[model samples]
Structure formats: structure tokens, C-alpha cells
Target: MLRTYFPLSFISTLILLISTCAYAEDHTDELHSATTQVTGFGTLGIAHSTTSQADIVRDLSQRSGVGASGRTSLALDSNFGLQLDQRINENTDAAIQLLARKADKDFVPELTWLYAAYTPNDRLKLRLGRVGFDAYMLADSRQVAYSYTWVRPPVDFFGSLIVSYFDGADAVLSFQDAQQGNYQVKLYAGFARGKSYTGHADYDFSLDGSRILGGHLAYQRGAWSARLGYSQLLVKNEYSSLVPVLDAFHTAPLATLIPDAAQLSAELGMQNKRIRYLSAGLVYDAGPLQVQAMFSQTSTNSLNFPDSYAAFLSASYRMGKWTPYATLSASRPVSAQIPLQPPANAPAELVQLYKDLNDGIHSQRNRQSTLSLGLRYDLSDASNLKLQIDRIHSREKFLVRKEAPDWNGQTMLLSASYNFVF
Candidate 1:
């Protein structure tokens, strides 16, 4: 299926490009007289991973390391983007970018961004169509080899779920001065509805959702730049199969080691469910050294589970040809309490069992921390190499089984990429 879809998608893109180019050619004189220009950029990479346990790292941009062989593989982290600019007048112009890449389960190129912008002046600009959310300038561009020092951004900080991009419309405003330098403020609001695949069987489900609003602000002067951003996601759960099981465990009786028929009857209950997240961060750069930190917290009011919060800090230094960096990240659940409610049909024994389990499980929350270090060497203007090592630790008082081993392992990655702009 992928093989068949790949060619068709490519052909369609080719046709669109030809049509756009032909249209531009028709107005060649006008375009040439205006500030019309076209440019392209891309990156290619390969990496390896070694883990003590069986784990698969699958995400939107790359999907390798699926088997339990604990081996390495080559990855084409390549992307091609086109920038078209046509000046309408001295003070106003039109601009748009079309980006394509191999993502998730599909190898065929898809439209990553297709937005038209109107920059009437230096202070303000309006954009509509597919837009990129400036979650974090560095984080957003982590997949680009030339954008950062690490072979990959810190997973502890970046995480698997939080780093994904969204498609929407955005507006940007700028302020600048000869002495003070420049600052950019961006406001992004969009709706994204798609399915994300995780390794877990029960967790994979449709992501038909919408985001009401979000934005970021950035300032750059001399050798330093700083940014701050905040965004919220309102997610609806489409998976209903797991609800019964979740509710069963959450409301089962707690008095007996094992619940009897009567107790089980008293425990069954129904409740509402919803998931929400809040994300924010800041970054700074000075000369060859840079520092960044970010924080994110998520909560589900309907679920009895506690809120989750994560934090990350990183610093990097440059030395002639090699630049080295280090990062630390940690996450833990927040505190929240609510009275246990059970369905009318639930048995008393079942309700007691659930209460016991909930009390035991709620006593301790999930906590994870990771430390990473890496170095990048600039091979040339169009190429670079990077090597990174990460040590990760996860602990959960309630979730850890007596027989199951705790999660403490190291992952080493070596990647090199060649990028070109034409």
C-alpha cells in the first residue's frame, strides 16, 4: 500500500510544482522585476541505538528499531522545502513555503506547510493556510541536523508526545531598533485532527481534536536571543474499549485481598473523562554558549489520576570545530484528591477492593529523569556529524510489579547528515 501511495503522492506534488512554475513563468517579466525568488533546503541522516530491554522508538519523522535485535539502522531524515517570494510593492510583498518529507507510516511526501503571508511593514505580518506553531524555535527545528548540537534533542525534555507539530494559521508582529536589535512576537491558533501510533495496543487511537489558541514571543540582540511560549490542548478521548477496565480497577472494592460477589456488585460506576495540557518554555543564547529550559503540565479532571509535569535544562559550548552540550530533564505527577464514587449496581466488596487499589496506587506517582551529553562537528557548510549518549531512569511506586525490573538504561546515538540549500 505504501509503495503504491508513494509514487502517486510524488506525481501529484510534481504536477502542482509544474503548474505553479508555469504560472510564474507566464508573468516572468513581472516576477523578475519584482523581488520574486525561489529556494530549497534538505537534510539526510543515519543513527544507531542500543538498549538493555526490548523497546521500539517510533514517531512521525522516523520509524526504526522495531524489532528486539537491539541493533542500528539508517534513516532518511530528509525534508525539502520551497520558499517563494514576490514583492507587490516596496512596502508590501507575498510569501509562501511548501515543505515535504517522509513521515510516520507514509514515505510519500505531503504538504507540511502551505501558507501565504502579507508583510505590509516591518512591524506586522498576516499569514493564512497551513502554519508551523513556534512551540520552541530550537525544539520545532530539532529534526533539522544543522539546527542543534545534539544528535537528537533531549528526549527527557522533548519527550515523545509533546514535541509533535500542529497544522494551522498564525500571525506575527516584530519590533526592532538600531541600538536594541530586534524582537518577534507570534500568535498561532489552529485545529489538528489526526491519528498517532504508539507502541501500546490499547493506547493507539484517533486524534480528532482542536486547539482553540496559543502563541510565542522572541527577542534577539547581538549574540543573544530569548523566547517564551504557552499553549493549551483540549483533547477528547475516542477510545472507549478501555474505559470499562479502567473504571473496574478504579472502583473495585478494597476491604478484602480478593473481592467477593457482593463487594463486586457495589463497585461499578460511570464518570466523565477529558484530557488537557499546558506547555511553556524559555531559552537564551550568548556567544558560543547557550542555555534553555522548558516546563509542561497536563491534567485530566475526570480521571482520578494526578496531573503530570515535566522540566528540562540544557547548556552547550562551542570549541573551534566541535560543539558539545549537556541536558537534564525530570517529570513527576502533581497532587489532587477527590472522593471515590461507585455505580449503584456495584457490589460492596468490589467497591472496597477498588478503593484499596486506588489508595495504594495513588500513594506514589510516576517519576522519570534523564541526563544526556553530545557533541557536534561541522564537517563543512553543507554537512555535519553528531554523537550523543543518554541515561534514563523511570520509577513508579504503584505501577512497578514486584517481579518486574525497574527501568534504568542508557541509549547511545551516532548520526551524520549532509544538508544543502539551492
Candidate 2:
């Protein structure tokens, strides 16, 4: 078996930190007022995609998530997650999180997080293991639906990348100023390996020893907070299955439209693809109203997957136990094109096929310019009920060349979820 894994450095560092933190915490507890506590949080959500030809998933990483297409036989938007935290002492803690989610008709349980965190001083804290590098405002709290207004985070923004964690270390800095607001920043590096959906099927890829470096900066004052973040993860992707797609381009009528198919393959799939992401957002939470807006972009050198951008504005008004919210989101691919100049004698159908291939480039995107309105009622402090409806458009296509493409459509979706924390 060709079993690939992260270098043991990430794992070994984790063991050392866990042992150090636990011992330090336990030793301090005997003489001081330090204590340990356990905590948990999660959500139960369901969504209905109204278009029979389209499946509306919460994020691109979800394999079997919800949609109206034939997938109606399944409810894809639902998921459950649990987290455990053990405080070794006032300055140290160990944590683990487990999530069970549906992917392509199967429910799989996986460990989402495992780490030990230590605060050496009031301003500095360090963490080691599998930890999320914040790409957005609520990036770390995304799985907790009750913390947000919508049925789900705007997919247009959050769905831009599937890989959230890297096996490594992070240093967090927080500064407090009497004259100014609070400032916080996080810096991290590690290797990220995972199976991500490429061309509709899951493809496995590793960091190839390239380090992942990223961080976020934030300022908070009273009821307002603003944040900006950027990250770069260079992936030398190996697309073994895509070899056939690149091979077929060399023969027959298709060759005319794509003369340098091999070059295109190298540009899109072969190696040295640096995936860079940028995001900025602001939030205002005061009185009975909560308002926020976010803008995000993913840049890379992949012809098949061009650079993408998204942004959204959301507002919610809280009325006792009832909260109503509205959101406007947009997503699109930039410089998404397939060069083509068919000979005049070429059959009309062949030319159309060429055009379809160009269209298919952006069709890989699942969300665009959506509007959502929803209401929420607190079932209790630990749980709440949400009912939401999204007006969405679909331009999805099959990734494999063999299957015929799906026509575009639009629909209104209904969603309901119950979120909890204990």
C-alpha cells in the first residue's frame, strides 16, 4: 500500500507539547487556584435544493451534501461535530474535535482537530497540532451555526477553499492598549495533506514538503471588530487520473481547439501551483442588531481553475427569542477562458463542443449571486432552530469528459437547522 502521511515532526512536536503543558498545568494546580474543565459544541442542519438538476451543498468539501437533483433521495446539508478540551492548568490545555459528515452518499467520522495550547504570558499563546488557520472572520467558529445568523456561512466566501488545517504550529499574539482598541494576530506554518474534490472526484495531494504560511490581523473596540487575513500554500499536485483527460486531447478533432493540451495540463495540474488566499471583513454587534460584510479572493496559476472572488453583506435584527436575517452574496471566476478558433469547414457541433468546454471552466463553481432570508428561535442557551430560504443559481457541470454536461438553472431552497453547545 502506498500510504502517504505527514512527516512525524508534526506528530512528535504535538506529543512533546501535550506532555509539557499537562505536567506544568497539573503541577501549578496543587498550589494555586487553577482548574480544568470539559466543553462541547455542534449543529444539526438540513437543506432542500429546489432544482432537480442542481445540488446545493454547504461547502465544496462536502461530497454528498444536499441539492435538488437526483440527490433528493438524500438530505446532504446535515452534519454533527463534537469537541473536547482538557485544561492542564491556568496556562495550558489539550483539545480534540470529532466531526461526522456525509460525503457522496456516505457518512464518515473523522478527527477534525487535536492540539495542545499554552499561554506563556498575557499577550502570547502557542498551539501545536492540527489547528485551523483563520481565512475569514468566523473561520475558527464556522462549524457552530448558533454563533451566526444564516443557516450557513455564505458559501460563496467560505467555500473558496476546503483545506482548513495544517499539521504544525501557531503563535498567537494579543495586545491591549488603553488608548486604542484590542489588537490580535496569529502566525502559523505546517504541511497540509488531504483528499480534495478536483473535477468532481476526490483527488489526493500532499504539500510535497512545501511549507504553508498564513496569518490574520484584527482590531476590536466595543461592539465593532475588523479583520484581514492572507495565506499561501504551495501545492505540487499530482493528478494521476487527469492523465487520461490530457491524453485524449492529443488525438482526434479536439486537438484543433487545444494545440498545447500538454502545456495546459502542466499549467493546471502538474506542479508548483501556489494557492494564495485573501480575505477582509467587519462586524458590528450592538443592541438588537448585528451587521457584517466580507470580501474574499483565491488566486492561483491553474488554467482549469482560474482565480475566484466573492463577497457578501448580512444583517440581522434580534427580537427577544426571535431573530430575522438577510444576506446578499456573489461569486465568480475571473479570466476563465478556453482559447478556440475552429476552421470554417469544421462541423457546427464540434464548434459547439469547444464552446461548451469553455463554459465548463466556470461551471465547476457551484455558487453565485445568491440572496438569503431566514428566521431563528432560541430553543435554549445551548440550542436554537433556524428556518432559511436561499434564492440561488446553478451552472454546475460534470468533471469527466465522458458524461454529458448539465444544463444551467435557478431555484429557491429551504433550510432548517438546530445548533447546540454544551
Candidate 3:
């Protein structure tokens, strides 16, 4: 089924998908004899940016398809996803999820997760194939807006890090709480590939790596819950940012001054690199009030590409079917100076080249802070409408980043969406 949003039909767009699924499910229940089940989640969103310099995107891998200086766009915030779950037996099961989204204003649908699971015992479960990284409290539920209060999880914690799927295996161990809370520990190992978003378009090569490993420990007791996770990956950054730069220099006078400078400096762009991530979070949801906070860090083995950290806190009060919430989030790069500083008296061309390499290394240093307030209204058992506005401030022209120098360093975003699950 298709949910189209014409000027007037936008109101119906929010409920169309959910209503369609609900109707189908109600009819199927009468003849329900299949072991397999199908379910879905979707969102219809309209958003605008005050900066008009860049679009607010879901994550680093995604470009809003508008902005970087444009009035408004729809390719940035609309998405649809479907899942199929099949139970082969008491011990075996399989599940798959596919998400349709726009990357750089164009449709680039991909598989979110697909795996076969085996439960041999009550406490231990094994899964193999493509699966989500258990990075945070809501990593797996990123697409399901109804599962969380935010229109999207904070970009600092979720968007900065790119690795989301692993083509490997995992084991989860479950245990009873010592007193009140229950516990679960998950360990995974695999290989993965990540595509790079060069602001408005994709780069020539994606980040491919091997020997990816991670583990997560979580505890929950009634209204209180906490989790900590860590993961490391051995990556080969083969995107080759040096070739074109070096080729341009071949005919320049600078080539004679510095021999094979581009090739020597190319390592600054990073290849055969290692990546590590650490994250922790706590949540409380009891009665009418809810609170949540999380912190995450991303680092790499190379000196050129250093580290970044982000943290955010949020609270919301539930009043009947409406939940009004506020959140504060901040992200900053642990910026580092390049070790190879050019001579002060060097030629202007040479000096600019050095600056180019230095800036390239610390490009992620655009620090940002955000304050957002929103209200969510439940429309039905499986659908809700959300209205949110965010004030964004940045230290540099980094965020709302574009392939070109389009970041205006500050912006405001107003958004509305209808989210549903069925």
C-alpha cells in the first residue's frame, strides 16, 4: 500500500499506513493459521529549517536531501519499514527487516536486519547473519518512533558513529536479578562495511572492515534500568582521499619542492585504521514522569582522525494521551593538532597545502549543542502525532554540514510527523 501526501492529503498520510495494516490484520485473524507473521512501522514527516544552510538529517550516513541552504524538503524525514518473523520450531526462528529511506534526496533502501536465531536453553540464545549493533538503549528501535519519545535519538550518540550492522554471530545470556532487577549480557563478533556520505553524495569507496567485536551488559528492575556497551573494529579505509589531491600536484611547482608529497601525505587521510566505541546510559520511567540520559564516545587508531564524545538528557511528563518533553544534547570533537606542521616561512601554496591536510584530519571538530521541546499525542493504539522544535548552536561551520562550505553554524528546526506501528 502507498501513503501519498498531497497538500491536503498530508493529514491522512499519518494514519493511512497504520489503518491499512490494522484492517488487514483484523481480517487475517479470522483465517490465521500461518506460523509466520508480518508487521510494519512508518512515518510521514514535514520539516523546515531556519538556517536554510543545511538540513537536519537522521545520521551521518544520511543527508537531508534539502538544506545546505534550501527552504524545505520531504526526502529527509519520511521512511517506511517492514518486518517478517517466522517460527520454524520451538528452538529455531528467523526474522528480517527492510527500510526504505532517502539518502542524498534519492531512494536508497537497504536491509536493516536479517537473522536466524536458536534458543537451546532458557538463558542462552545464539543468532547468526545480519544484525544490529547493540550500541545503545534504542539502537535497534531507531526507526520505530513510537518506541521512544524523541523524534529521533540524539545525533551525537547515534549519528556520529556509522557502523550499524554486522554480518556475523552473537550470543545472549540472560539471568535473574540478584534482588530486584533482571540482567542480560550480549556478545557479538563479525565483519561489516560502512558507506560514507560526502555531504550531498556518496564517496567512491565505503569503509570495509573485519574482526568486529562487541558486548553489552544491561540491567532492569521495574522503573530503573542501565546499560553499558563497547565495540572495536579493525577497518581498512580504502576511500583514497589522496589520489586526486596528489594528481593535481603532479603538474604544479610544489611537486618539485616536495617529492611524492601527496603519496606521503595520503596516509593522513587514514587507511587500515582501527575504530572503538564505548557507551553507557540510564533510564527511569515510572508513573507520569520519565527521565533518560546517555553518553557515548567514538575513537580511532590514527592520530589524524581522533575521537569524539556526546551526551544528552531528556525528561517528559505524561498527561493522558499527550506527552510533552524537553531534551538537551551536546557533541564535541576531542580535536587534535596535526603533528606535521609546515614551516611558517614556507611558500603560500605549500602553507595552504599543509592547512588543507591539517583541516582534513580534524574536520569533525564542528561542535554543537541543542535544546528541543516537543509534544506527542496518541491518535490510536498504534499511531501518534508529534510536533517538535529545536534550537541548535554550533562552535564552527561543521554541523548541518554540506559537501561544500554551506554550514551556517546555527539553525532551528521545526518538525511534525505521524508515527505508527502495526
Which residue runs does candidate 3 get wrong by more than 4 Å? 1-27, 30-32, 198-205, 208-211, 245-267, 336-340, 403-408
**TM-scores for all predictions:** 0.69, 0.80, 0.86
TM-score winner? 3
Report the lDDT tens digits of candidate 2 across residue range 1-422.
Answer: 11112235434543544464556546665524434443455555655555555555566555534443343332344445556577797799888876555543343556778999999899999999988757678887777777777778877677656576677899989998896799999888887745555435444244445558889999999999999999887775555655566666677656665566556556646356777889899999999999999988877776555677889999999999999999998877664444444456768876775576555455454346678999999988878999988887644432111122453656677888887765
Tens digit of lDDT per residue, candidate 1, span 1-422?
01122346655775676576667767877768767876455555454445434332434233333213334433334455556876666655555666565444444544545566677777888877665544645655655556667655655444434324455667789998778878888887676545543222223445445453677777788766666676655544433443555444434343233444333322321122334445665667777887877777755553333467778888988888788989888767775443345545678775675576465335334355767787778877756777666565645322111112333433444445555544
Cα RMSD for candidate 3? Answer: 4.4
For residues 25-129, write the lDDT of model 3, one tens digit per residue.
887754245677778887777777776555566676664434553556564567777777888898998999876665432444577789999999999999999
In candidate 2, what residue range of length 10 has the lowest lDDT sum?
A: 396-405
Q: Which runs of model 1 end up more than 4 angstroms from their true locations?
A: 1-38, 56-70, 76-103, 160-167, 176-181, 197-202, 240-282, 300-306, 335-367, 396-422
Q: How far in Å is the alpha carbon of 274 misplaced in model 1? A: 7.1
Model 1 lowest lDDT segment of ten: 397-406
